[model samples]
Target: MRSALLTSGTVALLFVLNALFTGSLVSGFAMPPYILQVLCLAGINIILAVSLNLINGFTGQFSIGHAGFMAIGAYASAYVTVAWGDRFRAATSFLPEFARDGVLLLFALAVGALLAAIAGFFVGVPSLRLRGDYLAIVTLGFGEIIRVFILNIDVVGGARGYSGIPKLANFFWIYLFAAITVVVVSRTVKSSFGRTLIAIREDEIAAEAMGVDTTRSKVISFVLSSAMAGIGGGLFGHYLMYLHTNSFTFIKSIEIIIMIVIGGLGSITGSVLGAILFIALTEGLREFSQYRMVLFSLLLIVIMIVRPQGILGHLEFRHFFGRRRRLAAPTPPVIP
Candidate 1:
């Protein structure tokens, strides 16, 4: 109870601090627009990395198709806001005007998450049974399938791209959801179900022998991961007020995977760090123009060779907070 209270208080304090820093309260002095944009984008990337970590990091599943779920969420939320924003707001106009728009955006996020979860369930059923490269192939195929379908769908702009979506996603919402994603994922990972996932990760055969329902665990991971990605996607689409089928392709999925890998698998804090750095790095490298991708790829190869476990290597934020490590006691007492 004390720990939970501390966590909540910390989160609230963070929200307050962020609002102040962004001048959301004062309204006169504020961060530069580009900086704010980067921060929002970083928040969204945090959600993406953490959600993908739930599958690839915690559950030991090598999923490479997270972009599909993200795409589903993006399009679903975009459709809601674009095709039905006014209708949703009108239906809730009885509430204060500010609250009414909030309700609409929240509803859109919920619906988007639901759609992604549904997609996850079906994909998980078959994909969960595979392992390693096979699983990667299945996921990659799923992402491609989603992209191709969206490309041909005229309703959501087909190959042209979606635009003019209501800009419902602001910095506040992005940071709020990013915090929620971290908290929920952290608590869930420390829970019993999360242990089963770790067990599966460590050794599937051994975990099965110990009565862990590996299949069920994998499926659950997929669903949860998908749902969070969907939420992130909703925020992403609305924030930009535009999306294209090409944006959610396999390459995008690769970027998410790279963030988790570079951050360190199975570390929630690592996801946060990785997301921030990844986006900043990409954005900062824009100076290279055409050669940026090549440079980024080369850098990744060097990092992988030097530190394969990632930047954090399963370390949590609390681990760096001066928590004492328990040393094993001498066996001399037993001899006596």
Candidate 2:
């Protein structure tokens, strides 16, 4: 109950912050539009990184087709909003305009997440049996296949890209979902099911021998990860009011992987920190746009060489603070 209350309070506080940032509550205190865009993108990246961590970091899966699920979500949600948005809004016409739009966005996000989860299940069932590079190859292929498939679907503008999506996503919605993603992934990591995933990551064969349903656990993780990614993609689509297969390519998946790896593979705190840093660095280097990739690559190389295990090296924020508290505590009197 306390945890639930705390979560609610945190969400409420975030809502107020979002209002301030968007100038909904205080026009004088509004953040700049460019800054708000960067923060919104950061929130989406946080959702993607944290969700992918559940599969790759916790479940020891090497699936790299995260972008495929993201694409599915983006296009699926955009299709709904473009095709039936008016109907949805009409059904909820009694509500204020903002509230009606929010409801429509929520419904679209749900559809995207559901479709992505379904795709994840289908892909995970067969590909998850393979380990390491083989799984990665399958997932990579899946992502490519999804892109190609979407390219041929004229209903969604084919290769031309899907446009005309409503701009319903705002700071409040994006950060709210990001916070929920963090809470869900963190709680899962602390649960018994999460222990099973960690055990599988440590030793799959041993975990299987110990009677853990490794396959089921992995598939479930994949579905949950995909659903979260879908939510992120939904927000991305609505925020940009566009959808393109090019955005959800193999490179996109790699960026998410880099976020988790840079933070610490097995740590949720690391994922959040990594996503923020990655986005900040990317945005900060916009002035050198032509040489940005080269500079980014060099910086990543240096970071890897300096701390290959990641910024946090599998340790969480709580662990770090707890260690500090322990060190600061007064020493007990020794009886001589």
Worst 10 residues of 2 by lDDT: 320-329
lDDT of the structure predicted as candidate 1: 0.91
Flag regions of model 1 displaced more than 4 Å: 1-24, 322-336
Clashes in model 1: which pairs?
none
Clashes of each: 0, 0
TM-score of each: 0.92, 0.93
Candidate 1 per-residue lDDT, tens place, 144-261, comes to 9988987888989998899898888888788889988998899889999999999999999999999988998899889999999999999999999999988899999999998999
For residues 239-260, write the lDDT of model 2, one tens digit per residue.
9998888999999999999899
The top-ranked prediction according to TM-score is: 2
Look at candidate 1 and tell me the lDDT of residue 276: 94
**Cα distance off (Å), candidate 2, residue 67:** 0.8
